[model samples]
Target: MTLNTKKDPRVAVIKTGTTYPDIKSRFGDFEAWFIRALSGNLDITVVDVAAGETPDAPGNWDGIVVTGSPAMVSDRESWSEATADWLAQAVAECVPLLGVCYGHQLLAHAFGGEVGYHPDGRETGTKQVERLAASDLDPLFANLPRTFPAQLTHRQSVLRLPPEAVLLARSAFEPHQAFRIGQCAWGVQFHPEFTEAIMGAYLDVQSPELTREGLDIDRLKAELAPAPEASGLLQQFSDLVLQMKKD
Candidate 1:
């Protein structure tokens, strides 16, 4: 669907990669998860970059949501690079944007941040996210608690943020769990769009990796719970976009 001139804040889900193959066979891709997560009263669109779908114009949509991907930002694939370039322009133009996981790293890299293999290795499963003092100033996270849990699964992390980017939240394992570049642009390293089942499924698929990493798989799975505060960000973002459009 064309994003060119929608009355509603048409948010586009830019899919950079598919869900884990096993997860995809059982559930679906990242787009479906985001759609469900947001479930906001607004027009939503899906642009599958993996399938060669790209938005016609950023001005067309009121907001954008970049989904997580399996592809590492360090790889610098042509499509990923192109999407990053487009995201930079989107931010410059004041479009409300939220990037999660791979999208988070891409947003950082697009704006001159360093993204690479995490020294501590993959951080999978539900984890605690501590909001930094600066987070109080961000509308997207002001209402969240100083400390909360969010679903996470990633090997790469944004070791450094772009110049002047606001550090919003962090976890013990991930120093840059969330950040904001421009007023309306944000990048969260955690999966705010995931459910407990999804988290458990991810742990199941990554059990070997977790086992090798010395993490207790059963304990992690049993502890998985819905991250209401983290999950609430999707709707909060939509509200922000709609409110921006109103202003």
Candidate 2:
């Protein structure tokens, strides 16, 4: 049965980079993950910026989601920089947006926040994320428990939040785990679309580096558990988009 019979809200997924070839073969690409994570509820379109696809006009889509990337925001790639400018314009227009992982860092940089290598280093594996008190009142995050677990793998983080950004969540390793800008834009440092298999695949590929960093690879793998609550955030965000279309 169709979950949304009314005209579904249109959402664009800005593909920043492709997934690891092995991972892509297994789970499709970033856009596939997002579509599945949201349970195919919204009318989704994909814009692969890495391949030179331009984002849809601001008036075209009801909302946008920026996918995580292997490239660092600090690298200042031309395409990446251009996407940031577009995001700034989208925010100015009050378009609902969700940025994940590298997308999260890029959102911060686009709005005057600092992004760089974490002071301590990479944060990989499933970890607890604490929703800040401010999240309690957020239209999307409200009523969520104070803490939840999510899959994460990143060497860079948002070291400083953007001006006027409302912080929404945090973890011991990532202080700016989540934040909101304007009334409808959000950035999450964790991967709400990542499944346990994907998380394990990441850990497997980074085993050498993780071991060298004094992280227990086996323990990290052992601690892996499903983060259903974390994945639900995507559904909530999509619902917010639907609500926005109504108003």
Candidate 3:
């Protein structure tokens, strides 16, 4: 429940949206997934920013994580915009931050980058993501392999990264799969928190729409596998936060 009194990093997880009813019943919501992935070493708090929950100032926390959402960043809803503003401040304060999916797009938007629906449409299921040469210099991604499988399900994406953002990784369909701003802020388009089962459930729930969109559901389901490397990023982030707090 706690780490060393002064050493434990206080982390706030900003929940942007809820998962499907079935998914929530089976695997819990977006925040739960992130908590599980991040593990329990760090002190973590969930803030439902989508529901008007305002979190403490970014400086109060040692680290911050923005969870993926069913909501689209392109809509720029009042709450989403407000959260973006808060994230901007978090970035300014140099908080150790990781934004996933919707969070990724929101971060880019907050930094004046462009976010919109992918021209090629939604990218779903497990896919191979390749790290760019720039990742070798990135603290969070430096040790990762050149290519790895990662879970993904997104319609909107960070079509353009912030001027100062460094491209970290990319998939065949998504050029902005992962990027980092400054030293501590990161945004990943892939769902590092998603397990194989969760990815399968997502495909099942979106089967009708996928079919209508001309995707082969069976093929996607069959390709589901554990993405250990991708999932491990959460723990790596926890380690980074803890180390930062110690300093």
On TM-score, the leading prediction is: 3
Please give the CA lDDT of all the candidate structures: 0.89, 0.89, 0.92
List, residue by residue over 152-227, the lDDT tens digit for candidate 1. Answer: 9999999999997999999999999999997989999999999988999999988988999998898888789889
The Cα error of candidate 2 at residue 215, in Å, is 1.7
- lDDT by residue for model 3 (171-217), tens: 98999999999889999999999999999999999999999999999
lDDT of 2: 0.89
- Candidate 3, residue 41: Cα displacement in angstroms equals 1.7
Backbone clashes (count) for model 3: 0
Find the number of clashing residue pairs for candidate 1.
0
| C-alpha RMSD by candidate, in order | 2.0, 3.1, 2.3
Model 3, residue 51: C-alpha shift (Å): 0.9
Q: Give me the displacement of residue 226 in model 3, in angstroms.
A: 0.9
